[model samples]
Target: MEVKVPKEIRDYQESIFFGLSTRQFICSLLAVGVAVGLYFGLRPLIGSEEVGWMCILGAAPFAACGFFKYHGMTAEQAAWAWFKSEFLYPKKLVFKSDSLYFDAMKDAIAEGEKPPRKRKNHKPQPPTGKER
Candidate 1:
């Protein structure tokens, strides 16, 4: 069955999906690059010693944290769950559109009330003592 979406809902969904997907893609790429760079940089220090295993183990958590933070998920799975429920759900479209419209209207009103631009202060300065 085909589903119908209101214009506002459709617009909001498009905007949010594009924004979040772009952000997630960029952040995931960055996290991967950082993790790779960190591994290469730390490898010299780690070497083939017994401490190398410890270093590798320590780096794993750091990489995981970086990945989570890049995705705006944080270290807390509960918080991420809450975020998906409260902010990212499809049903939140109504509230998002209302908020987006309210903000745009407020900005339009503010712009309308602004004063017109005035000319810059360009009056000539009086002659200095040195010139006199």
Candidate 2:
């Protein structure tokens, strides 16, 4: 008998039960538990139809968490990274460059070589009392 293996070793996941990885199995179990709990807990307060919807909604996140993987990161890791990038340590990068040569040569430029201009000084005139 030939054993099937993933083409990429990194993509391989050991199946714990029913062809599900340990993480998937755990998350699926949790999702089912949540759905059942929500259905029972909300059934008395809300109608069966609404309770069924609520159970699905409540269980979706748990199921998604187990299946989600990106760039080798799990759902929580991706979420944390997103949170950090969006809020915790967001960066607004401004590229500013200073030239040492330009600074050093500024005083030696043609404009800098010109002599400073003298300012005209005039005494202020007294205002006429009749002027409105």
- Name the top TM-score candidate: 2
Worst 10 residues of 2 by lDDT: 108-117
Predicted model with the maximum lDDT = 2
Could you tell me the lDDT of residue 115 within candidate 1? 37
Residues 27-117 of candidate 2 have per-residue lDDT tens digits of 9999999999998899889899999999999999999999999999999999999999999999999987598866766776646675456
Model 1 lDDT tens row, 1-132: 998778766334233344554444455556556556656667777655534555556556545553365343455675677788888984634533557656757866677765346889999998787972
Cα miss at 14, model 2 (Å)? 0.6
Off by over 4 Å in 2: 97-132
lDDT score for candidate 1 against the true structure: 0.58
Clashes of 1: 0
Each candidate structure's count of clashing pairs = 0, 0
* lDDT of candidate model 2 versus the reference: 0.91
Q: Tell me the TM-score of each prediction against the true structure.
A: 0.28, 0.70
- The number of residue pairs in model 2 that clash at the backbone is 0
